[model samples]
Target: MTPALSPAEVTINVVGALFAIPIVFGIFIKAPKLVVFGFIGILFCFSDSTWGQLETDANIYSRGVGMFYFSLLNLILMVAGVAALLKRLANPQGPQLAPPMAKYLAAFVFLLLGHVVVGLMQGIELDVILGYSGIFNVLNMMVFMYLVIMAFESEKDTQRLLLMIIALATLRAIFGAVRFFLFDGDTANPYRNFEGLDIKIFYFDINDNFVASLGAFCAAWLLTTPGVKLGWFKRGLLIAFLVLEVAAVALSFRRTSLIGLGLMFLFLFLRLPGTRKFMFSIVAAGLLAAVASVFYEHRLQFASEDDMLSSLIYDIAPSRGIKDGRFYELYAAAQSMDGNWLFGRGTWGTFSGDRERLSYHGDDFSFVHSGFGHVLLKTGIVGLLLFCGLLAAYVGFYMRHRNSLAGYARLLGDAGFAGFLFWVPTLLVGTPIIEFRTMMMLGLVLAMPFIAVGIRNYQVRAYQYDPRYAVA
Candidate 1:
C-alpha cells in the first residue's frame, strides 16, 4: 500500500486537484453552457463556514477561508461538469428511459427542492447550504458512476477506477488496523469510545480517518461483487485483502457501517435473481465473518454488541437515546410541521439549531439522521413523497436495468443503488445530527443513478435523428 501522504502533499493535492477538476470536467473546453450552469449550482456546497466542533482553538476565518478555496471551487467544477453533461445530452444515442432510472432522478430532484422548502418554514437560511451540498456531492458521485460506463470505451479506465477504489480502501484498512492495534487494549476506554475514537483516528486529529470512511464503504461495496478471477495463489492474496479490510472496519467498530455492509449484501441478493445462492454465499461468508469477529472481540476483550435483532424484533430500547429515540425524533419533527409537512418545515430547519433533543438535561436539538426523519424535518410531508418516491424509483430502476445496463451503469445502478439503499441502517444507529461524513457519501452514491440517466438522455438525443442509427 502507498504510504499516507504528508500534510504538504494533501495541500498540494487540494490545490492541484481543485484547479484541474474544471479542465477534467471538460465542459468549458467542449460543452460550455451545461458545464457552466451546473458548476454555478454546485458552488453553494463550498461556501465558507464560520463554526465547527472540537477545535482546540477556534477561528471563524479558518472555516470560511478553508472552504472558500476548496469547497467553493469544487462547486464550480461540478456545475461545469453538469453543464457539459447537458450540452452532451443535447444529442446522443442509447436506451435512456429505463423507468426506474427516470423515477430516481426526478424524485431526488423533488426531494432536493422540497428540502429547501422545508428549511424556509422554520425561517433558517440553510436553503443555500443544503442546496449547494446536495448539488455538488450528490452530482459528483454520479459523474464517477457514469465514468464507469465511459470506461467501457476503454478497459484501462475501468481498471483505474476499480483499482483506485481498492487501493484506497486497502490503505484505509492499514491505517485503521494499526490504530486498533495501538488502541485495542481498552474495551470501554473513553479514548476508544465512539466519540473519542472519531477524534483520535480520523476527523479531529492530524491523521483524520477520511480514507477509512471511504475505505469501509468501498470495501463493503466490493463485498457485493465477490467472484473468482484469480488463480489459487492470487485467491489467497484476495482472501488476505478482504480479511485486512474487514479487520480494519471491525477495528473501528463503526456499527452503522456494519449495518450498512450487512444490508448492502442483502440488497445485492434481492436485486439479483440469484437470491438463494446469494443467501447461501452470505451464510458461508457470515461464518468466516463470524470467526473474524470472534477473534477481534477476544483480542480486545470488548463486550458483545447489543442484540440489534432482538431490539428491532421486540421493539425494545437498548440505550436511552440509542434505542428508540429515533422513532420519537421522526414523530416530533413531523408533528411540529403540521400542514407544512407537505412542502416541509423548510430547508433551514434541517440545518438550523431548530430541533432540540427531548432530553431535558441540557441536551441540544439536532438532526435525527434517520433518512425518514431528516426528510420530514427538511421537507415535511411533500418532501417525504419525493424521498420515498425516489427510493422506490431507483429500486424499480435496478429491477428493470440490472441486466440491461452495461459496464459502469451495471456497477453504479446495481452496486451504487445498493449502497444508497442502506439508509435503512442509518435510521437506527442514527448518525450525528450535524451531517456526518457518511451522509455526503450516501448523497454521492444516490446521485450516481441520476448521472447515468442524464448521460443516457444525452446519448439518445445525439443519435435520435440519425436514420441509420435507429435502435436495432
Candidate 2:
C-alpha cells in the first residue's frame, strides 16, 4: 500500500491545487493562449525538481512523486498547445502561424520521431525510450514553442511576456538569496555533491544560476539599449533588479552562469557602433590588462600547477587531456558510438566502457553530463547534424529580420539572441537538453526572436493599411 500524506504534504497539495485553478479554468474556457502565458511564466519561477511544495535533490524523473507531477504538467502543456494551434488555424485573420525557421524545425522534429521508431526496433521499452532518453521533454518543448509563437501576436503582448519573465526571474533570485542567507540551508557548502562534482543547491533547485543569468542579461540589455526611454524611478528599479540577479548568480558559484554573463557582454560590445567600439576598446584593453596582472600574481596557485590560460584550457577543453570522470564520460560515450555511428544506439542505450566511473540514474545509463554527447549517443551523427541545423536556422532568422524591429521589439530580439548564445556553451558541457525546466526556458528564448519579428511585421502591415497605427 502507498503511504499516506502528512499534514505538511496535505497543506502543500491544497495550496498547489488552489494555485492551479486559474490555469485549469483558463483551459476549460478555451483560452489556451492565456494559459500558455501563465504556464511559461510559472515555469520561469520554478525549477525542474520543483513539484507542488516538494523539491527533490536529484533529477525529478528518479522519484515517483516528481515524475507524476512532471508528467501532469507535460500533459497540460500538450493539451493547451493543441487547443491554441487549432484556435489559430480556425481564424482566417490570425497572424502567420508558421515562423521563418519552420522548415528547419520540422526537419529536426522528423529526425527525432524517426529515432523513436529506431529505439523501438532496437527493443527499448517505450517508457524507457521516452523518459530516460529525454525525447518527450524535447518534443514537449517544441510544442510549447509553437504555443508561444501562436499565442503572442502583438508588440504589447510580447513586451508583456518579456516583463513577466523578468519579474518572475527577479522574484526567484530574491527567494534564492533569502534561502541561502537567512534560511537553515547550508551557507558555506551550498552545493550537493553529485558524482564527485558540486552542484549548487539553492532555493528550490540546482539551476538557479541559469535563471539569474537570464534575468541579468535581459535587464542589462534593456538598460543599455539606446532609445529605450524610462523614468528615473523605473530605471533605478531595473538597475537594482539587475544587481540582485548578478549577485545571485555570483553567490551560486556556477561557472556556467559566469560564462554566460561574459558572452552577453561580448554580444553587447559587438552590437555597439564603430565610434563606441573604438572608445570602449581602450577601456576594455585596460580591464584586460588588470585581469591579466591579477592572474599573473596568482599563477602558481592554480590546480593545474600551470599558468592561468593553461589551467583554463585544461579544465574546459577535454581534447587537451582527460583529468577527471567528467571528461572520461564523454570519451566513453564517444567510444560507445563506434558500432552505431550512423544512426546511433537509439534511446535507452548505454556506454559500458566507463560504467565504473560514471554514475547511473537509477538503473539506466542513458543520461549524460553533456547535452551534445547525449544527443550523439542516442540519435547519432544524423541527429547531431539536424540539431545543429535547427540552431543555425534560429540564429540566421534573427539576423535576417532583426533590422525590421524597433524599440522594445528590437531589445527583445537582441536580448533573446544573446541568451541563446549564452546557452550554447551550456549545451556542450551541461545536460540542459534533458532537464525539463531548462528545455522550457530554452523554448521560450528560442521563440522570442520570432515573436519580436512577427509582431513587428504585423505592425508594419497595419501601418501600410492605416497610417493611424504607428509601427512600433
Candidate maximizing TM-score: 2
Cα RMSD, each candidate: 8.6, 5.1
- Please list the residue runs of candidate 1 whose C-alpha ends up more than 4 Å from where it truly belongs after superposition: 1-70, 89-156, 183-228, 267-326, 350-366, 404-414, 427-440, 443-472
Model 1 TM-score is 0.62
> What lDDT does candidate 2 reach at residue 207?
55
Question: What ranges in model 2 sit over 4 Å off?
Answer: 1-30, 49-70, 184-207, 275-314, 317-325, 359-364
Write model 1 residue lDDT over 1-472, tens digit each, in one string. Answer: 1234567856875686567666656645463434433332232112121122322232211221233432434454454546545644875674343334445455555666555555566565553546432332333433433332332322233334445545655655565556556754323233335333332322221111223333344444444444413467755555567666555444434445555555655565554446445554665378437734643453222433544343332322445443254455555655566566566555444332223545421243435546566656655666566556756766665565455554444554554565564555664445422332334445445544554444444445546878475322
- Return the TM-score for each candidate structure: 0.62, 0.81
Global lDDT of each candidate: 0.45, 0.66
